[model samples]
Target: MEIFNHNANINFLGMRKFSVGIAILLMIASIALIAVKGLNYGLDFTGGVSLVVDFEQPVQIGEVRDALEKGGMEHAIVQSLGGTREVSIRLQPKDDPASGVANGGKVNLDRIAEDVTRTLQAARPDARLKSRDYVGSAVGEELRSDGIIAAIVVVLGIGLYLGIRFEWRFAVAAIATEAHDALVTVGIFALMQREFDLTVLASVLAVIGYSINDKVVVFDRVRELFRLARKAEPEEILNRSINNTLSRTIITALFTAITMAALYFFGGPVVHGFAITMLIGILIGTLSSIFVASPILLWLGVSKQDLMPKTKDNPELARRP
Candidate 1:
């Protein structure tokens, strides 16, 4: 199962300065992109009208999307509900200015629904409105706030767990790595102006979890090697640990990326945001585990003593390798 030699020595930490510089630059760029371009919040966050339309016969999603676009609903989010005959359409509240705001700045949901139905009927004579719903701006705002809180909580929770499981150095490195992965993942979305919705938010959180898992594996190896190597320096121990686990990390990321690619191509637009986010996160996370986390741990002065067992009963802790 090993893709690399069992006793490989690649000197990964030799390029620590270069890798760390690249990581810092990328993270800075990600932040800049997010701050400037901002995310293209989807129907779930921007508050919009949801419509379910039924046609007399099976129709292509592209055809429905085109019809809506021609009717001035270019930003509509269209997807198949179940079969080809049933389609779901989501439009931001601002799509139709005539029906967007009522007397006192309230969304005119009824008018928007009627307008959508009329537009669809014009395109297909038998197109019928199956259901209509509205997501208010207030609700979307609340969801956005809640999603931010959830992400912060998850990151903090991970830092706490790692602090307890390993040490403060590992915790700090893990936190930085996770933050880098999340920002880069989200930044790509903002750069591409991809729809940021509930599903995508979920994917970002999933990426944090996945990225940390990879780092923890490496961190675990580092601690083991530190304790086992009799007089190894922190850099030497980290390099050995990463090289030892290189095969596993690459293999895992390869298969996971392949699965995500399949999901992206076949899982339809409903899961596009999730699939794409996972794909980006995987690439960034894999690289960061090798280049980012270990370097940060080294810079934080992680040493054998930090991992050495303090128990007097364990004489092995003082034994030579």
Candidate 2:
């Protein structure tokens, strides 16, 4: 089970300057990317018309997209739904000034559905509309706002928990690490112009949980080492703690990344956003735990006194370690 020596003496903290520099650069780049390019919000976020169509024969996704584009439905998002014969099409709401429809006018779901059906029928005569749904711009706006609120709540909740479990230093370090992992993961989607949907958001939340779990493991080790080492410096204790848990962290991330890779390859387009987000998250989260979290803790001046149990009434016990 041990992929590395339990007694391994890797000087992880020795490279703190370089690693922290890289982490800070990545975080800055991620922030810039998000602010500039922005995320490619999917159907769930942007008000859109979605149609599930079934053709008598299997159809290539590219051909369907081409047909839609040729039919004046440009910027359509198309994907296969389980099989080649069925596909889902999503399109942003359009305005019809000629028909007196304003830019943010109510979307006519039935009319949009009819247009999509007609367009597809021209390419595939037997194309039949199976289902149609519409997300209003107002609704999408609310969902978007709610998603942001949820993320903020989760981050705050995590900070609160960490603050109580350890101390302000550990809490701040964890919050910063989690935020880094999230921004980098989400910023990649924005940079690549990938679809950011509900599934992807959920994966980001999962990444927070995963990243915090790793930090907790290492922090626990640090605390234990701090209590056990009589006169060891904080840096030495941190280095030993990270080294002791290095094997576990790498092994866990490896297998989890493998699982996410399989999902990305075999789980189909339905879960592509989720799978890919987790994959990116796993890589970033693992690296941040090793390089980012502990260094921040050290910089915050975490010491044995912060972690040592209060024994004011028992001077002998307090001085034992």
Candidate 3:
């Protein structure tokens, strides 16, 4: 039934303040960068005409963009996905009201598609527009709302589950850790100008799930130590718990990171961003679960007595073993 074992727990309580300060500073930087540069949202959430084209041979993104431009779609976005042979084309409505806007002032999707396709075809005779779709601005707004709701629900669910499983304080610590990791990840994306799309959103969720799983493992040990070593100080118990789980955490995180790195390097365009983001998340999650979250619990005054059951001298549940 044992997943893994380790020799000692690392004492991070001594450095908790410094670690948290650095994380907060980085988060601030990330927010500033996002505000200044803005996010480069994808077509799915930005309302654009999407064209999927499969070429007879591998084609570069530059070539596709050039083709679309020559065909008269001068401001289209071209990206390759799945493989270099497959390309995704996106065209925003021209700002000029006379051409893109409707006769009645409604958004004109049909005309945009028609003009984009014509331009693409004219630029490359052999290039065929495999499929096309469009999302109105109203639809994009809906997607943004849904994505935010999903993230909030996930964090709240993790907090509730942890509170029930351990104690409210442990749950609080875990959620703070999750927030830390999320903010750090977003900051990196903002600073590096990484694409934040639906897939990236999925990756962020995955990171939260993975990071919390690690925290739960460590927290379980801390709770057990709390019950057994009733006289031990909170810092001692936390240090022991983290040290005991250190090896397992490192092994699992490094293993996951290695696999993610391999996917990033060799998995082609489809997985490059996802793998990179996951790799960063796992490493951050592991570090924060130990150095950041557990230590903060100490600062917040979490201790063995806080978790002890009290029902006017409560009875201890008998161990089945």
> lDDT per residue, candidate 2, 1-321, as tens digits?
888897788888889999989988888999899899998888788778888999999899888988999989877878899999999998886668532246756677887888889998998898999999876768877888888888878888998998998888998999899989998998899899998988899999999899999999999999999989899698889989998999999999999999999998987666888999999999999999999999999999999999987787688976887
Q: In model 3, where do residues sit more than 4 Å from their true spots?
A: 1-5, 52-127, 309-321
Worst 10 residues of 3 by lDDT: 312-321
Colliding residue pairs in candidate 2 = none
Report the C-alpha displacement of residue 116, candidate 1, in angstroms: 2.1
How far off is residue 101 in model 1, in Å? Answer: 4.2
Residue 127 Cα positional deviation in candidate 2, in Å, after optimal superposition:
5.1
Expressed as tens digits, the lDDT of each residue in 199-301 for candidate 1 is 9999999999999999999999999988888887888888988999999999999999999999999987778889999999999999999988999999999
Q: Pick the lDDT winner.
A: 1
Predicted structure 1: lDDT: 0.89
TM for every model, in the order presented, reads 0.87, 0.82, 0.78
Position 150, candidate 1: lDDT: 96
What CA RMSD would you report for each candidate? Answer: 3.8, 4.3, 4.9
Residue pairs that clash (backbone atoms under 3 angstroms), model 1: none
Global Cα lDDT for candidate 3: 0.78
Candidate 1 wrongly placed segments (more than 4 Å): 54-66, 79-87, 94-97, 100-106, 122-124, 313-321
- lDDT of candidate 3 at residue 135, scale 0 to 100: 68
